[model samples]
Target: MRLSAEQISHIRAVIHECDPEARIYLFGSRVDDHKKGGDIDLLIFSKHLTERDKRRIRLRLYDRLGPQRIDIIIARDLSRPFVRLAYAEGVEL
Candidate 1:
């Protein structure tokens, strides 16, 4: 995985602050060792996440993780096929 221990820790902490039961996954290019310079892709699973919740979690994560391209997929927002694949293949953080 592309993330360091500290990065994962921060992400987990931020997500848990938003929802303690949230399930976080690290996927896409960041999960594969062979890839390089990919944005952070995260699949967050929680019960009944609203737009407000998404925004809050996003802002908090960016604030803690710094300014970078981060792609987040809430479980209920799993519309695309690739996102499902990502959830299946993604490493849980």
Candidate 2:
């Protein structure tokens, strides 16, 4: 994982604040140590988060992390191929 301890803790704190049952996973380039620069890809499994909640969480993350690309996928409908791939490859945060 390319994320620092502070980054991980902050992220977990932010998410858990909203939904304590939420499960967070780190995927994409950041998961690969050999890989170079890429966006922060996250797949969150949460029963409590609606679309609005997801958006709010994202906005909060951006505010904390600053201007950068962060792709967040809510695991609501797992029928999507990418969602499956992300979950399979992801490392839980």
Candidate 3:
């Protein structure tokens, strides 16, 4: 799925509002123009994300997007080992 510039901007804005220090990235088929995909994939990195925070973020995104399919992978900032593996193995959006 290709994200429009406006869609990207809206996503970034919502992410920043949720966690200013968070690092937001896009990956998977959305990044690969040649591939066919069904949903938008996002990797969110933030040391401050608790379970409550995750729920809130998810709800907020759903409210803003309204039925648009989204796959959010949340990780901590210090989880570099896992992040690096994903970076190398995952498709970049």
* Candidate number of the best lDDT: 2
Q: How high is each candidate's TM-score?
A: 0.87, 0.91, 0.75
lDDT head-to-head 2 vs 3, winner:
2
State the number of backbone clashes in model 3: 0
**Can you tell me which runs of candidate 3 are displaced by over 4 Å?**
78-82, 89-93
Q: Tell me the whole-model lDDT of each prediction, alpha carbons only.
A: 0.86, 0.88, 0.72
Alpha carbon lDDT at 22, candidate 3: 80
Cα deviation in Å at residue 92, candidate 3?
Answer: 8.1
Q: What is the C-alpha RMSD of each candidate to the true structure, in Å?
A: 1.9, 1.3, 2.8
Clashing pairs in 1: none
For each of the candidates, give the backbone clash count. 0, 0, 0
Write the residue-wise lDDT of candidate 3 on 1-93 in tens digits.
377777777778777787888887777677777887567777788777677776676677778777777877788753568666655545433
Please give the lDDT score at residue 36 for candidate 2: 84
Candidate 2: residue 89 Cα off by (Å): 0.7
In candidate 1, what are the lDDT values of residues 1-93, reduced to their tens digit? 989999999999988887888889998899988888889888998876767888888888899889978888887646779778988899999
Among all windows of 10 consecutive residues in model 3, the one with the lowest summed lDDT is 84-93
User: Candidate 2 at 50: error in angstroms?
Assistant: 0.9
